[model samples]
Target: MQQCYGSIIRRQQHLIRCLSTKMQSFSMSGLEVDAVSVLRSLAPALDPNKHKGQAGKIAVLGGCREYTGAPYFTAISALKIGADLSHVICTKDAAPVIKSYSPELIVHPLLEESYNVRDEDKQSISTRVLAEVDKWLERFDCLVIGPGLGRDPFLLDCVSEIMKHARRSNVPMVIDGDGLFLVTNCLELVSGYPLAVLTPNINEYKRLVQKVLNCDVNDQDGPQQLLSLANSIGGVTILRKGHSDYISDGKEVKSVSIYGSPRRCGGQGDILSGSVAVFLAWARQLASKGEHNTNPAMLGCIAGSALMRKAASVAFEDKKRSTLTTDIIECLGRSLEDICPVH
Candidate 1:
């Protein structure tokens, strides 16, 4: 009877251990990070002596005749999220429209589509485009690519060159929307660059797996797959956006699953990309100060995901079903204050 009782207790202990491991794995599978703490750590402290542009200088590299709203949302969001200077590099047709969206952004009309240039002018045009972007590239702390980028072959070709230049300068980049489409086809642009971050939505995540791993996405082993994809891409960080955002840097996987709204509205991704850029800049600064050895991309993704979810939740509370991207953008400052409290 004593032997049988001891056996039963041992089995129960084993069962409890298994349950605990499974629960941990499930939590790590989604947006599961110490997001509030990360946000507080990444946010720069207020200082009276800091100069202008000391906070961050961010660039948005997308805008076409058809899609101006995306770049505008991205650039403006960076400013709202505490970036000091925001710039937009876009085609001549897109420059004026994007400029009209706000006087705050430094809008550059540099990019040209194939339809507008003669075949003989292609070489010169490409050279000029590179020159224009090169003059401003090194000054930027981070660049957000592919917001409203259309699928024009000529335009994408120029953007390909721009990506190479950004990689050469070792400047950090956050790729999203059409940017993912471009990088998915040509993996070499960001392959092996630690500062590069790719933020992909559900469909974008599926396509990335098919392109890089040559297989379908496995939700059951999502974290492992995300780690593999980041590893396969030469250590570039990936933030797989979904019901919960999963982030990986080829080293470890983390998730940030707090404060979300069920609205599923469009343009939220743009807000996230913009917010990520600012936090990434801050994280890099903190890393430079030797505060922590954490991956800046990973920290940026966690904070950005958490902040966007918080703002969305706040917006939804007020407007409920009517909450739009603009409404959420309006809540970013308040949300950040709630979490980190500047004063």
Candidate 2:
């Protein structure tokens, strides 16, 4: 019995050593992704033969009465960055407000809040909402969830169903803002879904690490912890937003360190989620044609981060300390043009 216990202890120590070594390997500085090359490579050629929607069609599932600007920022950013069609599916109350923000967006007032729906109507309303979204689900190239989406119980339940449907259809999804809230609570929705990307800010990332890893955030080994977190969720890619965005999809880690403005604006993250959705859609398109070998999520993340930083810099150059999210959005087009010219 003594000998057996000793052997077991030895095996446990060996396992710990192996895990430590693996973590150390991942702790090394992340590889610097070539944002410009990836952008140019994944960018679809401007062809006259392509129809209006051929470039990309993105759907943003967010927006509530209290916060309409977030989804608006996300959806509009997609269009500004060259996506041909952008759609916003928000609550009935938020629909008009979001629509008022931009006529270019196709806004659908489909989601329902808890205050409006009685208990008995929950099932039927949820079903009807899903059915309505189903008609357009297959047409979208990507979905961005959780912009100004308030933390309404009934509404989140509906969004959860929508996420499941998106997964069933194998559609790519970028979860941010309130979307991260839903995903963290119901991790099963994205577990093992490589097509899903989670963009979490500092606070959001901390919560994610605590919930997923059963511990506090460990910045000392951020890349390794992020790797573990992504792998823990079945290889879903996570883009940890910060001074330098770190990206990991369980296979590798990359960072985008380009200098952005010091303004620390509020809607910047919404822009990133929207930008990522479009770039990811483009990356997936190129990959389908055998144009690139890396995962579309990584390319999308790197490109989106690079573009956001460049736009921020451009906006700051003009607005100085008074820069706003709208200012950054305005610069997205010019930054893309400078990065990849028509000629």
Candidate 3:
């Protein structure tokens, strides 16, 4: 009985700390949002009666010969974040390797790179790829674009078509890594889609600013610039990842400056993309049911940024200098549980 009382005290203390963090974040930037509260509200309770794919079905449209880990990371992260189903659509060379990483993923080796396809076969192959993706596109609650996607012109062309189809079907997408690269060149792919979320790091954000704003990244006017960028792209939400993630959906700008690990490990962005996808799907469902009136994409980005930062902080507490991306990922469940307990 005493131990149980102690556990209750500890939990209460943790809750207080979480609230304090939110207050602190709010003070930092007037635009800072309460990420912990957002996370709790967006994360649905686990229901025993929920059927497969009811919670969420996430598909990652990335992976190529030179890159497989990114897609695997994104797909698995979706599963780890409580998505009912996770799929990876990658090149044949990447499919086997991504499959080797985890059996939890449904790997589809349908994408073809330039070297593997002849000039004469491009049109037919592109059509086939789109048709194959079309079969599974509507079923997914969200699609995470980019990750390990190589910047192969041929592969990107196929993915562009896939994006178009996904848009037609009204599927939300979290674009990151190489996916941002593709969108940077062709802004129209996700330009007006409010359901689309772009997670861009320093370099990716720079390119996007240059392309869309026709100028450089101004630190002094960061928030306004982000607002303009999102507005210029037709109000698609943009999550500018950095020390403090700045999110904008054109209407307003919100910042998530939650504490995170200092270790700059690779693949963390992939986790963010996957996390955002899952949360975006949940938020969208809630919106559809009239549970919340806020923009799902904005809520998704806020929750995802908070969760990823908290997870990284937890992993760093344990591993410190040795903390890797996988370590941060392993802490995701615990971090989320702390913020929004399953019970």
Candidate 4:
């Protein structure tokens, strides 16, 4: 009788343990958000009394001879999304073309590529480039680095210096395109900085995994790997761009799978970067005011990804197979109004 009673107690304890574990898992899943709530929490109410630059001041650090459209897409998207000001810092050869894309953008034709600068003058030219960027760096709410940034050695070097300066001033950075290339190579530029966000597409994510984690991309355990990667980089947030975007800031992983378009246009990522920059600035503003609980970078990524997907969907509905990046950009304001009206 005693033996049977003991056995029953043991089984009861084991069942309780199993139930507790299951309950913990349920709790964790509950903490995972719908993402739209995050967007709503971060988006500020538009007040007519608000002054210029209150919405945001965004800067794009890219554009070169081979790639002018990318920086233009990024800068203009920020404006279309209601940023008070948008600036683009690009190579002189690319400035006029990007400027012509929109007169609203402040295009700085100060950056120089390897082909344009003599080897002996590289150091002095780089210094001048950094000086020009430094003057306006502090005024920027967020900097979007590497949209359409060519892999020019001299230009990359200058960007590295600019990133260092941005970090020192505690300005948040949204790194994409060739900026990912620069960060992947150095790692020191953004490692451990919570304010830094890396938005990497399939190939870029793979390279980042290989470079930082020193292993191949594991799709099955992608969330875990991404969590590890973000932790490995010292809490810097990463938005792994894919059919479904996964975001991590070392502590938790969240996926934003809402409202993505079927179109795979080239400049959408650029749009995402710019959008992320604006939202991040707003999120940071909220954080500084002690209003929100989530990590600002994570919130920025969620809102930016959700907004971009909605815009893409709206654009695709209108243009179908002919939908281009510009068409999608043209729909940003309307999409935002549909979700959270600005009145």
Backbone clash pairs for candidate 1 read 31-255, 31-256, 31-257, 32-255, 32-256
**lDDT tens per residue, model 3, 62-152:** 9999999899888988999899999999999899999999989999999999999999999999999889999999999999999999999
Question: TM-score ranking from best to worst?
Answer: 1, 3, 2, 4
Q: Candidate 1: lDDT of 246? A: 89
lDDT scores in order? 0.93, 0.93, 0.94, 0.92
TM-score of each: 0.92, 0.91, 0.92, 0.91
The residue-by-residue lDDT of candidate 4 on 33-141, one tens digit each, is: 5777777777788898999999999999999999999999999999988799999999999999999989999999989998888999999988888888899999999
The residue ranges of model 2 lying beyond 4 angstroms of the native Cα positions read 1-30
Residues 1-343 of candidate 1: C-alpha lDDT, one tens digit per residue: 9999999999999999999899976766543678999999999988989999999999999998888999999999999999999999998999999999899999999998877999899889999999999999999999999999887888899999999999899889999999999999999999999999999999999999999999999988899999999999999999998787889998889888788999988899999999999999999999999996899999998898899999999999999999999999999999999999998
lDDT value for candidate 1?
0.93
Tell me model 3's lDDT, rounded to 2 decimals: 0.94
Error in Å for residue 275 of model 4: 0.8
lDDT of 2 at 110: 98
Backbone clashes in model 1: 5
TM-score of 3: 0.92
